[model samples]
Target: MHFSSETRRDDGVVERDFTIGEIPGVLWTPEAAPTPVPLVLLGHPGGLRTMRPRLAARARSATRDGLAAATIELPGSGERPRGAKVDAVRAELRQALQTGEPVTPEIVDRLVLPLVEQAVPEWQTCLDALLELPEIGGPVGLSGGVISIGVRLAVVEPRIAAAVLFAGSFVPRVVLEEARRVTVPVHVLLQWDDEGNDRQVALDLFDALGSPEKSLYANLGGHTGVPAFAGEEAARFLARHLR
Candidate 1:
């Protein structure tokens, strides 16, 4: 929660870059917000630096809606060095894509499970620090993903009131089982023709969610072909639960 720099945006949102121990993160707060406003925890798709614009835009959207937003660099992303596990996973994924072979379940497990294990605790810790801030309050929401991490957080983090999950990633069986434990409200987005994802897996994972209140919005396109309106729809979903 130690901030190194702060910038004020034209939209009346203040962005701060910070570090909690070795983890780097950013927080965005709307100017003149009331004490203890709702908070949204964002998850990124790739390297945090590359995802900065998208994440910052999401923060601004949350801020404009009178909520605070925060996100952390996931393990082996951003400034963190890639450990052997992540390196192996990336190599395996690349090879599978290059060879036009469907990644085996065992390979998917190896690729995602360790990252899920490491990321969930880190997100919980980030949530702990975020809630401690005087300007943030209860009923947190989680948005974005590497899907498995979002599923795990929704299952274990009681503070998270809702989640907006992006369904463009694989789901290991163990993670699918854990998804059955999630009880928070969820809004899931699926790019129906995502080149790298298993469409059936995404559908099955959605089916596995234990949440009584969950909606799926599936569109016909590749991973990056999500329509603008879909994002707006997801934002509205978060607003409904968080605001």
Candidate 2:
């Protein structure tokens, strides 16, 4: 990982822009931390530029808790090259949602499964690099982003001590199948009134998880309407596990 730029914020959070291979990413660390700190991988729905503000906010929050945070562009997101096949699949999924049709497992699998396959390794690899930084040490946590990716990482990435999964997107069949193997503590945030999500499936996904220490925070809101306190609670959950 090569950090191309660095800036120290007024709030004492050090922000750096980086690239791992062709993947663009950013890392945030507390400027005056006395000791080495934990790390949190910030997950998103694939648009780094559009999502920067929120990602930065979460990173700053993590830094406030003496933990570093970082995130990279997902496989076809931001300036990364995207394929026609994924674009076509996305269009089909949008059309189905618009037409009020049930999103078939085939559609979800075609769109998200490959993303999970590609992203999980990138995260693991990124963790390898980010942990190399002297300021970020030891355990890691995952926050937000695609729920399926979070579930898969919590299952496969042994370094992930805890996770906060936002159930605002579709949980592919494969993700549900793998959920039972995720043993790390998980805090799932479900927006009960999200227009684009199936509430029942989100609940089922929560029920399917195998984590002995897991909590579901469901509130009446849309996809982007997660209450501020809900976020604080999720951060506390990660802090508890990582500490």
Candidate 3:
């Protein structure tokens, strides 16, 4: 991992922007923290530029609780080149929405699955670099999501002890099957009336999770309607498991 810049926040947190080969990312650590603090990996909702404020807030919250936090730019996002596959997928997704067609499993598989596949490796690579840092320790946690990558990681990554999933995205049938194997503690958040999402699908996805310690937080309003307190609740959940 090659860090390009490091910033010290007024709140006594240190933020470092880095790149591991083609992947770009940011890591945050509390100032004067002891070595080997617990770490949390944050997943964004696609656009890194727009997502930074929210990501920073969550990182700060984790730091306050003595946990290090980090996020990697998803494939084909940020300064990375928008490859043909991603462009085609974006166009298809937009067309499906514009034509008022529901995003079916087939559609999600074709348009979103590839991105999910690409993202998992990037996140794994980020985790490899993060865990190597002297300031980060074991019992990693995952927070935020569009759903797919979180489910994939939770099922396959043993280092992740807990997850806080933002489940407002479509889930392919294959992903649902894989979700049945995710046994880590998970806290799933759903915006009850999100216009852009299928509420039944979100509920069904939550139901399919095989974790014995899964909890659901469903609230009213659209995608952005997640109340401030919901984040507090998620922080508590991660703290319980990670700390």
Q: In model 2, where do residues sit more than 4 Å from their true spots?
A: none
In terms of lDDT, which candidate is strongest?
A: 2
Q: Residue 94 in candidate 1 has what lDDT?
A: 95
Which model is ahead, 1 or 2, in terms of lDDT?
A: 2
Cα lDDT tens digits for candidate 1, 1-243:
799999998889989999988999999999888678899999986588999998988888788788899999999987887888779887988998899988888888988888989999999988899899888887899998699999988888888899999995577779889988999999999999998888888898899899999999999999878798998888889989998
| Model 2 clashing-pair count | 0
By TM-score, how accurate is candidate 2? 0.98
Q: For model 1, what is the C-alpha lDDT against the true structure?
A: 0.88
Question: Candidate 1 vs candidate 2: which has greater TM-score?
Answer: 2
**How displaced is residue 240 in candidate 1, in Å?**
0.7
Candidate 1 lDDT trough over 10 residues, lowest sum: 168-177
RMSD of each: 1.1, 0.9, 1.0
Residue 58 deviation, candidate 3, in Å?
Answer: 0.7
Each model's TM-score?
0.97, 0.98, 0.97
Q: lDDT for every model?
A: 0.88, 0.91, 0.89
Q: Best-fitting candidate, measured by TM-score?
A: 2
Clashes of each: 0, 0, 0
